[model samples]
Target: MFEFFPGDHVRSSSVNLALMAGGSLADIGRWLGPLRDTPEAGLDAWAAAWAGMAHQQEALAAGDVRAGYLAAAGRRYLRASVYHATAQRQIPPGPTKSESYAASLQAFGNAMDCGALPLVRVHVDSPDGTLPGYLIAPDAADPRPVVIVYGGLDLTKEMLYATVGAAFARRGITCLVIDTPGTGELIRLRGVPSRPDYEVPTAAIIDHLQARHDVDARHVAVLGVSFGGYYAARSAAFEPRVSACVSWAGSWDCGALWRRRWDEAEAEPTSWFLPWVTGTGTIEEALERLELWTLADVWPRVTQPLLIVHGENDREIPVADARRAFEAAGSADKRLHVFAAAGGGAEHIQSDDPAPALDLIAEWLSLRMPVLPEPPVPALA
Candidate 1:
């Protein structure tokens, strides 16, 4: 991975995420240049720099909208949203974090409106609560296979859309980027914490998708990125409706992973992330709660077609997890693809170079699911 901050893993990861979301390198360089002398622990400085950039982009977007340059406005708003989300990621859980997150969501929504993107905000009723998501559907009206995408520890549905959902839609696949329990809107806004039984929420999301006229429910797939890899695997293990499953840098046992981290005395870059996401007050409590999140017993139950993608140099989840997942999965049609560090995409979720990973996933899906036909070109006005 290219480190924007030499020794600051947290800030460097944020940089990769920003780029993955289509942020401009020039603009990011300008925003972060002055903070070069700042220490790795200078979270406030990092947040301030990103927040300032977000404000500027928001202002530019406003001007573009007023000038009737809708496309330009959309582009600006998307940049602003990425900036706000980056700032939000650096802050601790508090009013400031809340404000930054809300700004990100607002900017993302504005981008959708200005661009007239083929996406819709959806809310599904789950036993836990309301699951908020964005559905990016292809232009064609025909029933299409849909993939439900869940993000990791700190990712929002909007970020998923910006990073991967739109690409899936362009491949003629309906992409539903959701905020399941424990992440995104549910965790940040509604105080929902991550649960061990992810299949419950997965079932709810599938139920909602099955009711949609534009979706081919029989061909639904579940994909999880980062920590969400656990969610995807767990869901497919129990949810019979899920025809396929993909785990992008997921884990075999998150609890054991945390324990290893603790034993190795390696602190998580974001100190507050685990406790907050797990709804625990301390690291010990969080570890105890995560014990039930393992897929050891469940992997054998995942009979659907499975694809596990991992980065050989992923600093977060170990590549061995992917291998173990593949070996244990009950699916007769299962494959594991590992990107070598030399080939790029060896970082977590292939953030270093996501193109190859993304292309592979799109092609893999095309082989197993029914892709919608390309929409006819419209007559010139």
Candidate 2:
């Protein structure tokens, strides 16, 4: 949509494709690039978009579709970069709403509790790490089918605690929210970079989920939110243990993400993107760093019950990327939902409206996986 947006223009810095010998392209193909005209302008768009996100967020209560608002968010500031040579303009983040973020999630969860959803926090360990995660479970059980939820690039496991936890808790199903690579405190404290090979870490999560005897091994499922949509789906494809998978706001590759940032900031050949280029690519020859994580490599292998949900208006990741992922999945049971409201569905998850989407997910999980009731709490050990 940025292509069609009035003020938006694709920044040349988005795609610095070097041609190869003969007519053949390099294995790392040069496709589409970023959208920002320049970092200064991107800042303006960011400010405008951020200013109105809260209103659309409120729209969820009123049953907005979500895709439109999401698109507006994208079209508004599709250019924003951490690159810092000399920003043309900087959109100062308004009153830190980390509190608002938490409150909104909590309020949603509380509403669920009022209706009898059971949510609990548990300690989970990933091979070399341990983290806190929320568990949403049905009441009463001999065994339970559990779903592990992984969220997108910008979200923390804490951010999902309310969304995923509350969503599943209401369904009487166990939903676990974990901080994987490139996300939240995990990335902050642990120098773990996001890997194209997502299963490496998720395998560790599965180990933790299965350790609980109350969890039904046959029915364990995995879900990814936003960028996590790719990771969770990829993991489900390789891990024989996963019975079903859901990609909520998915993308086909990480390459697109970085490229989008470049365009949003209009960083091509511009000093503003030096920091991002340095962090993700090869300014310093960092040993373990890689820029683009493509889904073309992982999609061919996925074979599980799958569901993909995306807002047509997503500005951050073009909806086309999500469509590519959905098309690539080999799963015979795959499903795709492109949300299109007046403002847009779940605007890249800061959706003006999220309940309908969440409700849809919960419903699908219920229909696809048989619910296992929570087992009685063991008498104090």
Candidate 3:
């Protein structure tokens, strides 16, 4: 993340993701330097800078493609996609927002052409229309244990993959990264808002996996990042098909957070972000509706092996909230790992440094959903 400007957590976090997705720091510096102390250092300003970087990368990618440097082009295209996605994160609904999103998806597709991974676009049948997702598999022929991943309020399927999908794939785990209702393309194009009953989409994903020959239907798990922790936990409670559940920062009650005074609420910008996610006309109405997004009633039903990974210093959701979740969970085999200062992932979703937390998650999943070894070849004799 670039430190050119002072105290814009949102922009800094977005840049963190961009860098994690293989963006160049020097290029980021180049874009960020001009915005220093400028009056236009807010949303439009950051968006313009990011879009600038994206356009530059895309042009370079195009040149590389023309010069038969497909591998290099692929790398640049992926970087461009990350830049575009970051650019559109906070922009209000408009042509610019739509264009940036389209650019991100297009660049991602272009990158896939050069052997990023075997990606299969899936449309899971859901009550709330089809939930679009990408299944990144290690191999089409091998039936691998799959991890279904979804992100929080602002995260998209592409971001989730860039964050951890590649790591899972490298460890031989197939990943189904979905936009889900109220997130990513679902929100942007379909106008879908978040719902507390995440079991709906969870079941749909399970059904889709069941129908697929490349997935190990019996060993599926669900992972939710940031605000998605609540969603994943809810899904695990109701959808018994989820063999294991990882809440990447547990959220006990989103409603409780909203009811608190702004000074006390850990989830900042709730007044702003909630309305957008709930499709409420006002923050008050959104706060009222968010009462439905709590896990107090759901955690007791979660009997699956649960892994709660929380940043000890998470600013958005308190570590105490994570403890509440862990205590309420009925699962006998559950762990609440509170990453402290000594560890690298002690921040919100470990967005700044995800390796330690991701390592633990991957290792945990490997134990529960061990990969199948390749079949021995027949002797030539």
The CA lDDT of each predicted structure is: 0.86, 0.55, 0.83
| Model 2 lowest lDDT segment of ten | 15-24
- In model 1, pairs of residues that clash are none
Best prediction by lDDT: 1
> Each prediction's TM-score against the native?
0.95, 0.63, 0.92
Extract clashing residue pairs from model 3. none
1-381, model 1: which lDDT tens digit per residue? 899878877688889999998888898899897787756537677778888999999899899899999999898888899899989886889987998899998998899889745678799999989999988887776878999998988898888877895677777788999898888889999999989899999899989988888777878898898999999999998889999989988579999998898778665555677788889998888888889989988899999988889999988899988898889999999889999988899999999999889888877876888774446789999
Best by TM-score: 1
What tens-digit string does per-residue lDDT give for candidate 3 at 1-381?
233356766566666667766678888889977776584557778788899999999899889999999888988888888899988887877788888999899989898887654688888888888888898887536788899997998888987877785667777789899988889888888889888899999998899899988787778899999889988999999998999999998999988776674546534643466777888887778889889999987899999989999988777788999999999999999999988867566778876677888888888887777788546789999
Q: Write the per-residue lDDT of candidate 2 for residues 332-376, one digit (tens) a residue.
A: 888888888564463554254566777888889878887745466
C-alpha lDDT (0 to 100) for residue 211 of candidate 3: 94
Ranking by lDDT: 1, 3, 2
Q: Which regions in candidate 1 have their CA more than 4 angstroms from the true location?
A: 372-381
The C-alpha RMSD in Å for every predicted model, in order, reads: 5.1, 12.9, 4.0
